[model samples]
Target: MQFTQLKVLAVSGSLRKSSLNRLSLESMKLLTPTGVEFLIYDKLDQLPFFNPDLKNNPTIEVLNWRKSLKQANLVIFARPEYAHGITGVIKNALNWIVSSGELLGKPISLPNLSPRASIAHAQLSEILSVMGGDILESCSPNASLITPYVIPCDTAKNLCDIAVINHRIRELWNRIETAMITK
Candidate 1:
């Protein structure tokens, strides 16, 4: 299949009902170019912990999650920082995916929306890369997309930043499209 027509799966790290990270991932889906499709996994909390003891007797949900990752041409991760690091939920989810062997060499981008920019973003990029995910690009929103964690007040300005983030996403897809052509 050509990259231009590939399906991209996006998963948000946060489970908050109004999570900015989830909003960011949805925005990416809305902004994706024609011929590309984005599917957001809303069941992060349903995944059990990664355990070798239970690898063979995996639950149906875990099996389905792995199947989705295998089918996706690329993965987009939008995460939030908890206590100056990636949340436990997101980290655990990554742990489960790592054992699937489907993520090796897959193109990925980790654009975040957080108040603790430098530390959280830097650490997450390293972690994902070390786990064999290709971290293509990352960005942190200057302002909170949700309330009470205000870094700024201009929604329009934040929307502008989101536009740039979407462009990078399209660029990644274009690369995938090109790679698909040669293969």
Candidate 2:
């Protein structure tokens, strides 16, 4: 009934500091259940393009990225649609690990930022699935309607979007626990 050492690693396709997707990940961190550490990976830019030659001898950044993937019990991705497809940065990161098989059997939560991003999410889902990741459908938050707004607000409706994010995370935690127990 109790779980420990749970670390959720979040990676967003957007590199911009002001990206709504990135801010959503930050918000999700606040709603993590006790004892579950949520971390956002911010070094995607430092990783080089995936190269077969470099795989034999990877740089420190690449090494660290792969290590982070291995360290996480669950990997959550918040990606925005760029031309109806995955962002180059996140795709590149995936390419780096696809051949290494570090994420095989790893549970990944893909929060589809709906409306504007369903295509990108579907594409990413197929990609991760091919790479052997177990995508948790319950954790897939359809945040199409929730605008990323974090500020002092008078209306309860403004704050309710945060509830949407929290609800998705809670669903993820519950399903993960159920899966672990059944296994």
| Candidate 2 deviation (Cα RMSD) | 4.0
Error of 2 at 125 (Å): 0.6
lDDT of 1 at 40: 93
TM per prediction: 0.74, 0.83
Look at candidate 1 and give me any clashing residue pairs: none
* Backbone clash numbers for all candidates listed: 0, 0
Where does candidate 1 have its weakest 10-residue lDDT segment? Answer: 147-156
Residue 15 alpha-carbon offset, candidate 2, angstroms: 0.5
- TM-score: model 1 vs. ground truth: 0.74
